[model samples]
Target: MLVSLEIERVEPLADGAPFGAVGAYERVVGKAKGEVDPAAPGNRGIALIDKAPRNASGKVEYTTDIFILRPKDFSRGNGRILYEVNNRGRKMLFGYIADGPQGVNDPKTMADVGNGFPLRQGYTIVWSGWDPDAPRANMGLGLTAPVATDSGRPIVQKVRDEFVSGTRGGALETFKLSCEAASLEQPRARLTMRERAGDEPRELPLNQWSFVDARSIKLRDGSKPRPGWIYEFHYEATNPKVLGLGFAATRDVVSWLRYDAAALAVTGGPISHALAIGFSQAGRYLRNHISEGFNRDEQGRKVFDGIHSHIAGVGRIFFNTPFGQPARTGTQHEDHFFPENAFPFSTAMQSDPLTGKSGSLFRGDGSDPKLIETNTSTEYWQKGASLLHTDPLGTTDVTLPDHSRVYMIAGTQHGGRAGATTDAGPNVNPRNPHNPMPAVRALLMALDAWVVSGQAPPASRVPTLADGTLVEADRTGFPAVPGAAVVKVTNQVAPPGDWVNPTPPAKAYRTLVCKVDADGNEAAGIRLPDIAVPLATYTGWNEYKPPYPAGELADRDGSCLPFAVDAAARQAAGDPRPAIAERYKSGADYQARVEAVVASLLADRLLLPEDAERYRERAAKEPRVAP
Candidate 1:
């Protein structure tokens, strides 16, 4: 339970400016102190919890950085709470939901609030650090967790670390380890380099590289590692943290605020319901949290009423284990051996014929909360997102539980950055800049209604085998555009235990992706105006340029290949996709088409009004359809 909350500071938010009907808000910054009984049923499942140091009451103690924003006048505030699990200790809620600028981890000004969507809705915005090893830069929030020991002695374990230099200027002269090395002895560690994940590693001579310190290593002769090369390090490390406590910490913090009267002092008003939204790694954390049964608090109460798991695909965090690394994510071209993608990829129950293990993300207990699983196109290409709704073999679609909904934000990349140009790092084609935030804003409101008032959300929107919109990667029917690379590979899924083995089973789950239209745009999911009235062929996959390994997926990036300007340009470029001039009669015509799609989406409750206007405004200035 949350033992105490140490308030560090409290101040007016955005200079005390009123936000629509929500009135002026205040920010509360503090540290949340909590503990869990190792012998308790709620805590025993935590890895190495029993080995952690205990307090006077025989409880393992922990502290987490907490930040909250709510109305100054408590009675005027919404009784709902929105908690965003920090991604690498930085708060991303404002950037995605509020359309706020990035790198504003510490929001104190009106500009930091962007359009003020959340504040206007009167939500008590909450963020508490759940990652123990989350970086401290950029005012990052992190948890202070206890390390596990064996009978008062340090527990030692072997840890693996991987690094890659994807750019020409990127060279590794020195490398840092997540965990401190137990010894500086060269023989105590093994280092190897490979050009690709599937290639055989070449062991570096001991004389070529030496340990710079217990926590770092350097090349002796000033040798810089080659770009696109994967460096693997295996070393002995001591002190494994009770990382699973992070789940309990989050549960107790939310539970205490909802159940304990002392929470009134923090929230200003009582919080009747809570919702959680996470992106990428944090999103996968939510999956692990629910599957591991952390949704049920120590007192047997549900924690979050609703959850928005975004862009996580069919992955879970490599958390809650001995020497777990929460920062590592498994992608096609990187971090391949991590335990991020494995069995039980779906919330539905299905058996992995290879592993002989059968289970679902939900525990089937009454503690299960309403769930909304959303993903971007990059997830289908690089993270095996189809598994979330498909069977283990990817041959058939599985039905989601009544309380769950899935939506695929079509024609976008992993991080939906705004703007039309693709200036992604180390990618051959322009990266996809088709932001899907507008659709997300609408979905969040729908999720709130589902949890707060038992209102059903919009039906799930995703490509399915039954509809013939989901197909194998090779059969996506992607256009043969000039200089464009078709997806030849997708992330393979193996049993959960295969992550730790040197060689996983050669047999793997079948990979699938959303089919595309004649224009090379995704044919399914929530299509925004940018996709509906397209000027480019946006895709979920981008190829790595030279220096980096060719033919491999450019780490979680998507491609945006714009069509030719006119018929002459189209014929000259041999572009099969119709030219912008040929598709639309005039710029005004294109704007009308975009507005029509936006209006339809709004009627279906898939697009917010403010966001719909933003789309229309952008369409008016679209240069591709200019007269």
Candidate 2:
């Protein structure tokens, strides 16, 4: 027989409040106070208030009077309600309440103005399947008894460490109780950043930069045979001293699904979150390399050009370098960033290296300035494959042996752009259009289905080429290569100790100004090793264009952040719609696309007629929601 459970409270806690608290009742009162009209479709009125008195030790105790709703299938007997309670809102307390006919209602009451001594403030009903020996035929009110409580100490301590010392407890406790009642599971991913401390210089290798670790915890019960799985978290760090060996690693553990694994799914935030921290740390380290001059000049322009070239060179070095080469554990070098004999132009510039021209560049004397020198053929640009083929983050050492499936995506930026917009001024836009969440979710769903059923995922589960065509899978129906590889390593040559300055000196400097033209003037200032360049050459850079107002230049300085190009610009620039659309569509579309591609592989036989109809029907249906 099917059983339905419905719970209602007369004086309920606020939207987010722990049970049995004055604030909880206050929330209900607040809702009643804000009600414009009770008859409105969405209007809800508060039903009760709570008042607590402090004891001798100044600790407050509270009691709540709430009306509980009965389930439609009520069969009175010994009924119990399973729920959780939290302290304030921080600590989680899991427990149950029991009710019976013996302790029904109390007639001894206190009288208030305009009310009787004994009042029916609220009612609660418990429902269960019909039993021949049950005490009552119809539902009735009964006394309440507390059951077991789950400790909220761990969650409360974590919040205190991460946010404030004690402010978050109440909010967290209330959230926990509400989540338990609604059957929502907390996300189980952790984002952490690790940098070498001054005392631990020996622990980190010399010349290595920083290290970031993204961990997704998978909890499992020892009694269950199911194994744990941890997906690879990407890591990237750069060190100028360690030429041709920028570190990168990505590792995914193979294992069976556990209870928590089914509830807490892997999301895209871990990889990008770790990368954001790593990149910020890298940018701080590279501050000295930034150009020290502003405006167009014979020497300053050359310096700016050189800095851009250096950044491009760094990009080439990283892209061509492979993880774990030459030595097994000791320091090793790979030319993946700077491939042996291969030019760096392919990975460095937005324009063709051979042409020396950019789509954004205009014609005239300013075009193809002789000051621009091409480093496409530099030694740093050469390409050659690395000898090492093992996982960089040492996944094989930490992950379960049973875990097998691994997927990686490459060529995408660290964090995806939320939407297309060219307004990202000086800084790199956080929201790059190439966000990997949609694709990652699709892959995870495919993995889930593959694990639950005997069927394997089709090759087209991975993203298609820039064109709107499906990429064929290997004979095994899986992609031949992993998505992307990320590595984390410390600089072995110039350890932090080498540059440690216990008594750093103070600095003093002044600003310098120069004339740009009849209506413009350029200003320059020194900010340590790095030069500060403003958005406009003379504060009138773009001549008051569509994106600029009079006397306001598109500042490249920290004042104006850089943003990615948006959809309108992409379309105008001839970007293919299908290529971009596939990245954001729902999982159903992704599944359909994969199945369509799979159908093409067996167009001649039973695979087409038998599987096509079934797959099409499944694709047409919306994703199943959990009951």
Best by TM-score: 1
| Candidate 2 vs. true structure, TM-score | 0.20
Top candidate when judged by lDDT against the true structure: 1
lDDT, candidate 1, residue 494? Answer: 67
Which stretches of candidate 1 lie above 4 Å from their native place? Answer: 167-173, 419-421, 498-501
TM-score of each: 0.97, 0.20
lDDT of each: 0.86, 0.18
Q: Single out the weakest 10-residue window by summed lDDT for candidate 2.
A: 248-257
Model 2 regions lying over 4 Å from their true place: 1-402, 417-422, 425-431, 457-627
The sequence of per-residue lDDT tens digits that candidate 2 reaches over residues 273-303 is 0000011112111111121111122211211
lDDT of 1 by residue, 1-627 (tens): 999998899999989999998899999999999989888887889999989999889999999999999899877777889999989899988887787888788899999988889899999999898888898776788999998999999998888888786442356668777777888898988889997889998988899888888878876777887777788888899888888989998999999889899999999888999999999988999998898889999889999999999999988989888888898888787788887877888878898876788988888898888999889999998788899899889898999889888899889888785433578567788888888888888999999999989989999999999999999888888888988777757877765554434675566787689899999899999998878889898888888877778778878889989999999999998989999999999988998899899999999999989888888888888776766
Model 2 lDDT, full chain set:
0.18
